[model samples]
Target chain A: GAGVSQSPSNKVTEKGKDVELRCDPISGHTALYWYRQRLGQGLEFLIYFQGNSAPDKSGLPSDRFSAERTGESVSTLTIQRTQQEDSAVYLCASSPRGGTGANSPLHFGNGTRLTVT
Target chain B: AQSVAQPEDQVNVAEGNPLTVKCTYSVSGNPYLFWYVQYPNRGLQFLLKYITGDNLVKGSYGFEAEFNKSQTSFHLKKPSALVSDSALYFCAVTSGNTPLVFGKGTRLSVIA
Candidate 1:
């Protein structure tokens, strides 16, 4: 209730399969972000949505990675033809607002561990 | 573009001793710096942030960070260390409307 929430904490899939990870941001939050974290690696930015509009999408590793948001409430990240390299923990975060980067601390979800075999 | 750097991959500090985790940033204009901690099997928890004014900002769990304007650095410090404090610490920065960009992370080990 006090933070962001993500569904299906652990997801395991075989290679070439498709998976959908969901993120339910904090109520009333307007900025949401999607990131991927490989084992022993830093967080890799995926996409950012501000009020259903994504201004920067260059972080997507490939065209296989896609994400969408609706009315600033929920966001879904879809990975198609997933490969073994896609195995990692996917994280989601939200803030009160976007654009200025000041006075806004991102609240994060526990993350969804995605394992592609 | 804004970026954060955590030079150390791992930091080892003895219990009861003070600890420091270094961070630096590069941004086009003013930089917003933050520190977050991740315990085992837990989501990243925000520790503190440096927005403006205060050079030293206190945060949860007795952690504090100093923002140095000239050095362009925001280093996290604690007067004393605890074993439970051992975790993965990340430094992040945000400028303009871009999403917060994180550093590679520094694994802090507070040995008891």
Candidate 2:
């Protein structure tokens, strides 16, 4: 089966510009998660969506970050007025189920490298 | 608050020697622990997980992790290291329905 896929492997944007990163989760995956990986820092959770219900936006760092998942499938993470601090690799992962107890491994996609100049 | 700690910034070992990367966690109740590996220019790859009923869990690429409830530790280990095993390793923990909290990754360098 195809793993999770994200588009625009690399994107360079000017500061204050908006950029949208897309993620296509595996077929039938009920859960999707977004994370940011900055150099010398661990992966930071961004947002999560499960089964089309209200997404968990708690991990979003700021109001400039927002994400939308449609029908438990494709998801888009947008950053408005991108900043140089936002430069990092945005990773998307999917799992078959929710809850922290589930052993279903998270399948990750090759992340989008967003560089804000 | 739930958290994870990877004390070692880097671990170097000779190929064919045993290797271990230490991780400790703090969380209320039980902990859902996982180990992931990342090669250059790649996304994290799940290596193994320890949920319950087992202290020693084996995972992909001949990697294994031992869960120690008393010490609040889940240390990744391998019997024999290979040069290809060199990469960044992460330890993560989640309690209940919360999202995974990752530790500062440990870079493993296996010298052949």
**Candidate 1 off by > 4 Å:** A99-101
Off by over 4 Å in 2: A99-101
Window of ten residues with lowest summed lDDT in model 1 chain B: B92-101
**What is the Å distance of residue B41 in model 1 from its true position?**
1.3
**TM-score for chain A, prediction 1:** 0.93
Best by DockQ: 2
Candidate 1 pairs with clashing backbones: none
Q: Kindly list the per-residue Cα lDDT of model 1 for residues A49-101, writing each as its tens digit.
A: 77756446779999999988888899999999999999999999888875333
- For every model shown, the clashing-pair count is 0, 0
The model with the greatest TM-score is 2
TM-score of structure candidate 2: 0.97
Candidate 2, after superposition: displacement of residue A109 in Å?
0.5
